[model samples]
Target: MVRTIRHRTMTTNSSKTPSSHATRQQNSNKLSRTKKACFGLMTTVLGLVAIELTLALLGVGRSNADGDPMMGFSKQVPLLERYVDEDGKAWMRTAENKLVWFNDQRFPLTKPANTQRIFCLGGSTTFGRPYDDNTSFAGWLREWLPHVDASSRYEVFNAGGVSYASYRVAAVMEELANHEPDLFIVYTGQNEFLERRTYADFFEQTKAQLWLTGLVSQTRTYAAIDSILRKNAPQESDADSIVLAAEVDERLNHTVGPSDYVRDDEWSDKVREHFKFNIRRMIHIARSANAKILFVVPASNEKDCSPFKPDSEDGSFETGQRSFDAGDFASARAAFQLAIDRDICPLRAPSNFAQFIRDLPESDDVRVLDFESELRNVCIDEHGHDILGEEYFLDHVHPTIDAHRQLSRWLISEMREAGWMAADSIALNELSAETVEGVDQSILGRIDRTAQGIAMRNLAKVMHWAGRFEVAAPRARDAIELLDGDAESQFILADCLRWTGQIDEAVVEFEKGVSAYPTYFRGVQRYGLLLLELGDNDAAREMFSIATLGWPETDPRHWAARFQLSIAHLGACDFESAHRELQECREHTPGDMDVVFAIAEASVGIGEPEKAIELYEQVLDEFPNDVDTHLNLAHTLLSTKQTDRAAGHFATALSLAPDNERAQAGMMVIDQLKQSAE
Candidate 1:
């Protein structure tokens, strides 16, 4: 019995050991599973928190899912259009499409029968802002000029539009060429420099933007990838837009690289060339369309108001300086000094710009009037703050109503000097009428007689210059009757007859004018130009030579005479003589593109394509955005068998000015060639 108990205890002990081992293994597995589950839950919760934090930091939650800002405000707004009233008969829209109407009836276009109609073309100042129509320069002109005769009346039409430059004014002239006005008055020059970019600069920027946009659009897939990367990236500061806008404005205004602050002489040359080219084109169009063109140089704010002076030692004129320098005599003197330093003297600068215009042989027909000195004198007050005073300007730039009035008065004086006035019969009737019954008749009669002669002579001269042969002839005859054998009148009569297909009669009048005023280059030059047109080459050349000898070297007519002589040589097929004349022109004026192009054409005629190519390249270098140059260069390249290079340039040219047919055709050929090569 004891042996059996021992055996049972041993068995029990063995069984308990196995069961403990199994229980220990089960507890170890359960602990491992619980640890893994806890770690996974913590990781998932942390990841969700991180995502929420990122969205909040990016401001993504405030924006729509598509990435637009939640607010409905747009960054850009459309530009407003502007318009204005023209005369009493019609309303005209401004370039920006704003509506304006004249408040006065005195400047009405509808006068009595046979009125001397004057149409004025210019920009905003000419439009007479802040002044009612009755108080405008047009109204003043109407009040000033009496009717010429019973058959004639006096009327002034203010056709000026706000912000219009010479180009737009030319367009208006073209539109009104058939109106049969006795005179077309043009007052401009200020807006030309400010309103539009030089043609070359405009085209260059246009091309660059187009090409860059095209390249960007072509790489849209890459852009999309970048957008995705940017979205996933960490958020940063948001001051980029303000900085970018400033950079853009600077680029647009300066047109030069930011690192460079010095004036770009190359760009200045391009600008000069551009203005010269466009002005020449304008003159040609005006002459061809029989419109008398007169240029008016406007006063500069700096010249009228600023008080800066250049340092004589360094030639540096600091801008934005409005304080007088020590020892300056007056504010006006200081302002004038500042203007001279900045090259803002309207008379001087416009004359310089006009000199460039006149340098072109094709621009001999246009006339330039210098009103700078007169306007300057008129603009200054006794206190030297300008006639309109400091408070009359919105800024340093634009003029107020009071300023406009001053401008008007100045313009009226110039017009009077130029001999623009009304008719005799209308003057007599107006003086005799109830409106002026109480006025002084003797003073009115004397004024009327003086005005009649001046008006008739001026009307005749304007018409003759404009190539209105039929209309001008009668006016000239009338002038000769009223002014009593005036030499200038005879010269104008001769020009009118000559242009109207009455050569012999014109020669007679020209001879009479020359006999009366032997030193008058005007008569001589007109005769010379007429002779040239009639193919009397030798006579034309002689007349031009004589005129040059009589006129001062600095005179515009002197250069004009030289140009005519050059044309005569060119017409005679004397390329050597022509070249000599052109060289003289270049010596007098460097970078004259018209002369340069003419020289290049002469070189081409002489079978010097290599020289032509060089000149053409020079032109392109100077005016890379000139469509004509690009076309010419493409032609030259094609002649030289540079097909691929020419194709690339043509493509670039077309990209800049999409309306270029030649470039488009060239591009098409290039595509075909490339495809065949592939």
Candidate 2:
């Protein structure tokens, strides 16, 4: 038994040994293949890295790049080219390609000996919107500094652009820094949410997202790949969540009021974070360039301007205005602040902007100016009001050109304290009417003579956009008086009056300008529609005539005006005229269903039953499920004594619209007719 067991064990061992050696050989081959695959992957990765590095060194994707994690902050250099004049002086002027939103101002690029350059940067206020930079605070400084300090030359450049948020201002600062800036005066905060932007994807402010953004934002290789992918990407881009457009399309550009805005808490938080981040980052940028920076606390016409979009449905902003009227200043301020905080369309920056600036640590290169307090003091001292309003401001946030002078004087005080440039001590008494900048007009009168009137007109226009018709109307009227009833001002006035429910007044304003400019017909057409709504057919007809008179027949407005005229004719019960106008409208818009329906209704009113029946049947053939068309055809058939056809049409109308009162009544009338015949 032992000999048999040993023989079996030796035979089993010999078979198992051959199988083990075969398995070992197979394992060795698999391991060698795995090593080759790993080597190939590492080689491919290293080769791709080398290619990326080579492309990066060649500057494949480096333009408009800031230290923007996620690359959502699009930084653009100004469209300025440096040139040397015949006098061996370098200068930089606004490029021709610069959009209409920016100013056409020029400044010296090469600094003269012992000269200090002061850059005034912000949004429309700094740009002096409604007029130009000549009326801005920087304009006051440019004129005032020359007269006050004749010892040293001071160069003040207006680098402000319209609707420029702080991030955009920082972009401008980056460009200005390259030209040897000595000091930068920033007076931003308003217009934070003026532009529309999105970061819905990869924007939860997560640690992992931030880390990836930081890594990707710094790499030229990533940007190059992104650019290639962007060119091949679909029209609806996924990269929008991590990229910002170079140009801004302001919220007020396409519509009226805050219709485009919504109550987005997350978006607001993002804006707040970006706002602070941009301003704080500017400090480092300025310090790196050995330039001093002063940030001014922005103020708004909180009491005068109603909220663009109220948070509450119960008129919280209106209630706040009523409180101010009732002499409750404390409650009024609180309400106004709340309105600003909860405003859906944040055209004006919130109070947190001021708080952020105040909280910033001050140093030799960084300082803060309290322009809000200065404006409040001015209002209380002269106007007997603690809250700033129209007395100090022209619109929501822009200070009047007169107020701009005082603001510049305060800036001079701040600059002098900081020992910047040749700024000397300036008193309120010294900046009188006879001062160098304070001539018969404000600082801007040297540029545009009609700037004040234009400012008032612009003010009225924006107020209308904000849905403050009452505030808009008076400013519009003032603009008319100053502009001598210019067509643009008259049109704006009419718009304001129409919104305020003053139909008669609006008509007068509209008519005053319609004959002068044919293009003013757009306003006339709108008012004519308004009159039609108010049942003033004669006035509407007159407006339609004005809208259509001498206009090109091929133009779309001619057909539209004719259609409106037909409606007015129908309103006056002029069936023949309505038919004629609708026929002409159909010639221009042959496929228009509205014109076809109108012609059918006009034929019925004209007592042409066969013609009306033919048109109604044509409409029924196209829209077989249309309950209104079936009801109209049934009524026409009943009028023509086609009882069977009328009954069928009524049945169809009833089926299509069971709950329709007209369809039910028509069906009942058809049943009654059939019962009477029986």
Candidate 3:
């Protein structure tokens, strides 16, 4: 006989039946209900599968206009599916109002026969962060290209993205194979530690999972869903929304976010390994596609800007700390320098990563542009030590706007030397130092105030991440003041206020952020969470509900809001309401293992073990490495007297998360069952 599932809080009929026939009728009704639920679930799954297949077949949601997939951090980069030229070429208008090629520039869908195309790939530095494309090194290179090679129409596309690590660049290069790229110039490695996305995590995914993620990412469904989940108030102005994108997408803001800190040597080793492999893979991909590669060694502010993360407690670092505490500034500086050189684990890449980059060129087909050395040579102090202070760098790694201009001049020289451009070109001498400096300053003047605000907020966030809260908080205020009505700056200010123990003030700023932009998820979600912390569950629920009301039905944030609301309901012992919310969340995030498990918990709460079992199984298939899913599935199987199957899952859960109390208890239960059976 199957064991009965214990329902939480819900009262059921406990009165005795009138007769045997009445009892039999009740059993038949239960069977019918179970079958109906199963059939409904199956139908939903089948329908989704059919839709996915059809969309894939039609190629309705694939590459952007430039044939690149939507970039990572999809929300930051907006897709302009709105514009299609007469030739059917899709164009993406950025938050800056510049209608650029989907990935780089708007050109013919096919490369023009008379054009010599050179593609530059990197992270925010290459993308010209805190400034527009006109001020970028790539922009400088584009103008210089025609000077050196007047015979051909030069096309230098800057294929850089904000926060794109080397692995992402590798993926882009792999896709560039079909585009007939004449030359591929890479200037990455700075962001490798920023995002730390590995090849396995970034590219190695099941075909089905990839298809689903890619399809949703490429379609406008996600944007609509994001808007809905954000509770984008219909009354919000377009200008306000545009400002939100700049603030949110500002690379400086992430100087201390998720990918900023590295704790140990093991993790550092993994990131370094991935970086090496990705760069090699990128070169191979370009070479195989018949494109010559110019790998630029990335540089940073080593002497002046403090390390984004604390150095590992190696002997040298410990000695440096001791020297500093002893008031020996000279010894301390030397020791600190040694620590930086010897520290086994650092957030930003050490000198060795640069060395590897400089050594990338081995043959005529490949060459290295040593910007790392060039920056060091020009940034030296009278004492003969390398000095990279605020004058040269905007922050820890990003260069000042002036540096970008000089970088372009250096790259031009390297191009001439590498035979990429003819040395005899009359324009080589025409690119005078005075001319480049004048151009750089001119572009700096053209930069929008809002862009300047973004740079400030980013710098503020980095300071906050570095634990200089006192410094960061005021800068955040300045950012909001600089860019009036900017919701992103307001959000950052609120974050700073919250960290500084100014709870009420934080709430006010968060409210302002949400008011400025209705569909801003960070503002809404953070505000709701703060309310929850303050014991305002009712208010939190209302906020989350309003957020989900207009959001895409399938958005992850929609499901996230529902899940949180469900938890709140569950805490209040409102099991029925909790179950309802969980069901809705599951529908929205059907592919999400967490949502699936949450629904399973709801099924268990409502005294439906079979349903819980089915949901848990689905979760397992999606996330095989998830110990909690395996543990939950084992518990469900054990409740149903499936001891043998339960034991296997229990073992898997134990293997995945050793010393887990639940898995240990589950093992004991399985052992007792085995002994009893014997």
Q: Return the TM-score for each candidate structure.
A: 0.33, 0.76, 0.48
Candidate 1 residue 86 C-alpha distance from true site, Å: 19
Q: What C-alpha lDDT values do all the predictions have?
A: 0.54, 0.79, 0.66
* Local lDDT at 488 for model 1: 77
lDDT of each residue in 335-415, candidate 1, tens digit only:
444454344212123345544433434223344554444444555544443332234432223444345445545554444
Which candidate do you rate higher for TM-score, 1 or 3? Answer: 3
Model 3 is weakest, by summed lDDT over 10 consecutive residues, at: 239-248
Clashing pairs in 2: none
* lDDT, residue 185, model 3: 85
Q: Which candidate number maximizes TM-score?
A: 2
lDDT of 3 by residue, 460-551 (tens): 76666665454466557767877885666677778778877899899888878877787776567767777777777877776676666645
In the range 1-678, model 2's lDDT, one tens digit per residue, is: 999999999898987675777889989999999999999999988987897789877867643334544334443546567777899988897766664656777778768887878888998899887677777888888877765566777888887888888877887788778788889999889978988776555456776777666565556677777788868977664645655667666777777678888899998888888888789767866876789999999988787777787776646567678888998877777788778777888877788888888778887788898888888787778866677777777778888878888888788777777776454545445655677535425444576436667878888877876787766777887787777666666777787788778888887877676767556777778778878988989989988988887369988888889899999999988999999999988887887877887899899999998888888777777788988888988899999999899989888888888899988998889889889989
* Decoy 2 TM-score against native: 0.76
TM-score of 3: 0.48
Against the hidden true structure, what lDDT does model 1 obtain? 0.54
Q: Residue 37 of candidate 3: its Cα lDDT? A: 99
Off by over 4 Å in 1: 1-113, 130-135, 147-151, 195-264, 277-286, 289-291, 303-369, 379-678
